[model samples]
Structures are given as structure tokens and as C-alpha cells.
Target chain A: MAAAFTAIGGKWKLTLLYWLAHGESHFAGLRRRGAPITPKVLAEQLRELEADGLVERVVTGPVPARVIYRLTPYGATVLPVVEGVRVWGEAHLQRTDGQSVSDTAMSCASSIV
Target chain B: MAAAFTAIGGKWKLTLLYWLAHGESHFAGLRRRGAPITPKVLAEQLRELEADGLVERVVTGPVPARVIYRLTPYGATVLPVVEGVRVWGEAHLQRTDGQSVSDTAMSCASSIV
Candidate 1:
């Protein structure tokens, strides 16, 4: 329960999954994508993802030691799950203010400002 | 996708879901459950859930106006998805450190401390 949810629930983690789900990318390449996290955080997230078996790490050791990451078959399974979330988001996109869920209601009820 | 993900992704959201999945509760009643949040935050979350149609709010007027919230049929759909996450979490519970996901991996690899 916690694992899979945590897998998708990581801050900037979902975005990483969204990107990796597109295809594999090396560390620098991912950083260039302008992820909303620092390189240290990014690398940390990727490594953890790898250990959890949700991602595959390929290290090409020749000189600079290139390390690339991709989602595993299990990670791919989250597509439908992620898709489920995406569907929900799309349907409520306007009302959700792109934040997904009903944050709007709380925004209305509570003055978090 | 974003909507559903965000819905389930809210802090204390899943915990709320777990509680609602079992039964309904009101503002003060829920507070006594030892939720790891403030009364203000709980009411805010519930109101947001109500607006999202995931929760039905019952307001009884007389004095302070008691408002009790319960999950709606639409909100019920999230059960399977949350269950999916739960299954994933339980499967990896020990390794997950109760924080859910593989946060431990990052702890091991990156040492957030």
C-alpha cells in the first residue's frame, strides 16, 4: 500500500515518472528537463526508485560513467493507475485549477492565505 | 489522472479515506481520532472533499450548525485505487518504514539526515 502510493506520491516523483514513462533519460538529460527539484534531490529520487524495483539504472562505464534511468515492467504497470489519476484530473481540470482533487473547495472554505 | 492522483495525494487525505472507507465522522468526532493535523486543516480537507463530490456534508442548524461529512458514491470509486495503493504499501510495509514507498532507500542512499 505504502510502496506503490509512495512510488507515485513522491514530490516531483510523479513528474519523474511521467518523464521516464515517456522513455529513458540520463542524469544530465533529466536535469535539463527543468524538473522542479535540485540535481541532488533528483538523483536521490531516481536511486530510491531503482532500489524499489520501479526503475532500471544503466551505467555505461567508460570515462565519465553515464547513468541512465528507465521504468521497469512493474513501473509500467502504474501506467493504468496513473492513467486512472490522469483521467480524474482531466475530467475535473477546470474546477481543480490544475491542482487535481478538490483543493478548490478548501480554498473557498478556508482562508489558507 | 491529475485529479484523482491529487485527491488521493493530499496529506491526511489517504488517512481520511481509510477512515471514511470504514465509516463517517464529523469535525470534532474526527479530531478525536488522533489525526496528525489541526482542526482547521481537517475541516478544510472535508469541505474540499465535499465540493469534489467525494464527500457529502450534512449541516444541522440550531446553534453552531453541526456539519458532518461522509463519502459519496463517486468518492467510493477511489476505494479500489486507494486499495491498490494499500496493497502496494502492505506488500512493501517493512521495507517502506511506515512512511510509505521506498523513502528508506533514499535514506540509505542519500542520507537525508
Candidate 2:
């Protein structure tokens, strides 16, 4: 359990996975979707996810390279857990603050199985 | 999402919650169930959980005193997420290491809704 947490426990990693699972695969797409994560931090977290075998990085083209990240099969297995977090967070926000879960948050929660 | 992770992201917090959800509510029971977490660390994590409104601490009896920890209604919402983690971890262990998820691990995953 601890090992699993260490692999995907970053503040932005799960959110990144949430976006990727919804078809945001390219680097720029992920960065734009993950707005609060600065470019440097996003790069670092992606590197960590790649190292942990949860994400695969692909490079294409000649002069200007395009990099894309996709979940490994192993990584896809984490979607349920991410959904769990999203569900819990939505309930938590509603319970504690009397506010509806945000559209982005709801989308992330509803995107996976 | 980031705030949610910060509240429950400790290595032992979710595992501790798993035990509590299964009815091991006393401090000593939690300690025994959470074998990998040292007493000091358990105390620290429990403190954090209490502060986050996920746990409630109760003291009963006159002589010797008994302290029990249980999930708040708010805290109970997180059980599904923990279940999700347990499922993912079991599948992850099997896929990567060709081994079953430990008994303790499965119980943690199974105890909650």
C-alpha cells in the first residue's frame, strides 16, 4: 500500500492521470488542462510517473519533436483509485462547505470506471 | 484534489482508516493492526486525522481511561477511496511481482463500502 501511494501520491499526478484518461494525451494539452501545475513541476511529475512505470512517453517527428504520454496497462489500473479519490473529495467538499463539486472535479470523477 | 491528498496522503493514514473501518477502534488495536507503523508514527498520523475532522477521539471511564478513535461521518466518505486503493494495489502487485496482495491488504480493501 505504501509503495502504491509513493508511486502515485503526488498532488498533481492523480489529476494528470484523470486528464489523460479523458483523452488529454499530448504534453501541451496536459499542461493546459493542469493549469495550476507550472511547466517545470509538470515535467518533473511526468518524469516520476514515467519512472514508476505508470506512464509511457513517446517522441515523434523530426525538426520539432512532439511528446505524448499515455497510461501503461499498469497505470490504467489506477483509474479506479483515482475515481475513488474524486468521489471522496466531491462528497467532502459538499459536506464540509455546502458547495457542489466543481465541473472540472465532477468530470474527473466521472471519467473513469 | 490537492487539498484532499494532503489531508489523507500519509503512508499510514489510509491504512489506519482501513483498520478503524473494520472495527478496530482503540489505539492499541490500531497499533497491532498497523504493524508497520511505529507507535510514534501512529500517534502522529492519528493526530493529523483528528485535526482534519476525519477522526474523533473519545475518552471514557474514570480509572485508567480508554481512548478510542473512530471515523467521523465525514471521514466515512473516504472508505470507498481506500477500497479503490486496495484494489489497485492488489492488481498492481500481481501484475508487477506475480504475487497475491497480502491478507492484511485484502482485509483493508474489503472492510469498507
Show model 2 residue runs off by greater than 4 Å.
Answer: A1-12, A24-48, A61-66, A98-110, B1-12, B24-48, B61-66, B98-113
Docking class of 1: incorrect
Candidate 2 clashes between residue pairs 3 or more apart in a chain or in different chains: none
For model 2, residues B15-101, the per-residue Cα lDDT tens digits are: 777777766377777766535668888899899889878999988756453888889887887877877776676556555763334
lDDT of 1 by residue, A2-48 (tens): 23345655545555666677689888777776434588888887877
Q: Report residue B107 deviation for candidate 1 (angstroms).
A: 23
TM-scores of chain A in all candidate models: 0.70, 0.81
Residues B26-110, candidate 1: write the lDDT tens digits: 7776776653568887888777777777888877765453777778887887666666555554555455455533344221111
Each candidate's TM vs. the true structure? Answer: 0.58, 0.66
Worst 10 residues of 2 chain A by lDDT: A100-109
What share of the reference contacts survives in each candidate?
Answer: 0.27, 0.18
Candidate 1: regions farther than 4 A off = A1-4, A27-48, A61-65, A94-113, B1-4, B27-51, B60-65, B94-113
